[model samples]
Target: MGLFGKLFAGPQVDMAKSDANRKKMRELFNEVVENGQDYKLIFGFTEDIGWFNYGFVHGSKTKIGNLIVGWNDNSQTIVVVPTVPDLSGCGDATFYRRNEIRKAYQSKYPTDAFIIYPDRKGYIGINVCDWLEDEKLYVYVSQEEEVKEFTDFFLKRFQTK
Candidate 1:
């Protein structure tokens, strides 16, 4: 490979590293949540929202790293964790107990509250409403099955309420 080849090559995405990171994230989630095996794990990415110049921008799609969501139907709890590809940038997993969430819904359009994040595009937007001092947890997933799984879980739990 010459200098031209190096320059022409696009960003190198290490799928193996990404997979390992996802696994590590699941392990971390299990460590925090009780009866982790009972929870359904949904893999996705957390949008890194930021301000540029005078308005919000998409920034990098996966700059914040992978996102793993653990949902337990029996316990009525949800755990959200963000894991970096290298595992060093991992943060504390957020837990949403049964009584903690006041409401939840899916937003087709990105609201002002979530405008800073990436556009909804073709991804599914799940808004976990009124949890952790009114903080909103917005998760965007690209896969069709993942979208169905997440929406089904939340809609069944919160929509009727």
Candidate 2:
């Protein structure tokens, strides 16, 4: 490596690993389509509280894929993806409850940059441009009859189904 490259580079990110993770995220998203009416598309990783703490709560952007999957105890899985996919430079998941989870998971997974949060209400708000329109996505699973609700929502809103 060049002296400048060596000196200026902050910790080197494993591109291969990142790509694999991204691929998995994409595949899971496709799974949502294939499964149809069985899964809800959430916004953040809600597989577990710890994963949520790492990926969403901590504000760590993977730069891999803009999605994650979570399954409820009853075998209901929700695939979470962002419509405003580019969250590279600036991104944030705001909320008190999320903040609390992020703080607690910090020590548990100190070096871990991203962990998938499952089965929780996660939302992402984006302001594209002043002239353009703003978009917001809220990913969650309802306790009531959510299959039809989520399926219809995904199909009508995102046109992905």
Candidate 3:
């Protein structure tokens, strides 16, 4: 765990919240994970404006909850999670890329271009972020073990099987 990770103690801090988010993430993950599913929003609210390539973009104000968005190239769809803390009150949480995320990770989860921060437990896990806006099929999973789980989930959602 990093300094902030130790300070935040993500694993102990919100295991319940994290577990709850994990369960929620799983549901959203499944939607995108399905082998036959087609174009659909996996999590947050979005329009069919078609911003990224032929794919659609999902941009919503994040909440305290965990959110994940991915493109299933085989299924030609998208998966999204809207995690906003104090939505109506505060501003939206920002994002960055993996390399970018790593920088922030080094800097302690700074919101930037297309990044995701796994709650706060060092390297125990990662907050999944769909980096479609900045780059195609580029996402960062804070949790390495969950990488494939996240990828497969997204593959099912945004790819054409």
**Cα error, candidate 1, residue 143 (Å):** 5.8
lDDT by residue (122-161, candidate 3, tens digit) is 2212344322222122221224344455455533432222
Clashing pairs in 2: 45-117, 46-117, 46-118, 46-119, 47-117, 47-118, 48-118, 51-115, 51-116, 52-117
Alpha-carbon error at 106 in model 3, in Å?
17
Sort by TM-score, top down from the best: 1, 3, 2
Alpha-carbon runs more than 4 Å astray in model 1: 1-23, 54-65, 86-89, 111-144
Tens-place lDDT per residue, model 2, 1-161, is: 89999999865545564444344444545544444344433333222222225544553333322334322223423333332333222122222222133221111232312232322664322111101111123222121233345333423333211
What is the overall TM-score of model 3 with all chains considered together?
0.27
Q: Is candidate 2 or candidate 3 better by TM-score?
A: 3
The number of clashing residue pairs in model 2 is 10
Model 1 weakest 10-residue run by lDDT: 129-138
Per-residue CA lDDT of model 1 for 1-161, tens digit only, reads 99999999965545565456446656766776667777877754445465445355444332333556777777776676665434444466766665655444455555311111122333223333211111023222223454467667766764423
Could you give the C-alpha RMSD of every candidate to the true structure, in order shown?
10.6, 17.0, 15.6
- Scored by TM-score, the top model is 1
Error of 3 at 109 (Å): 14
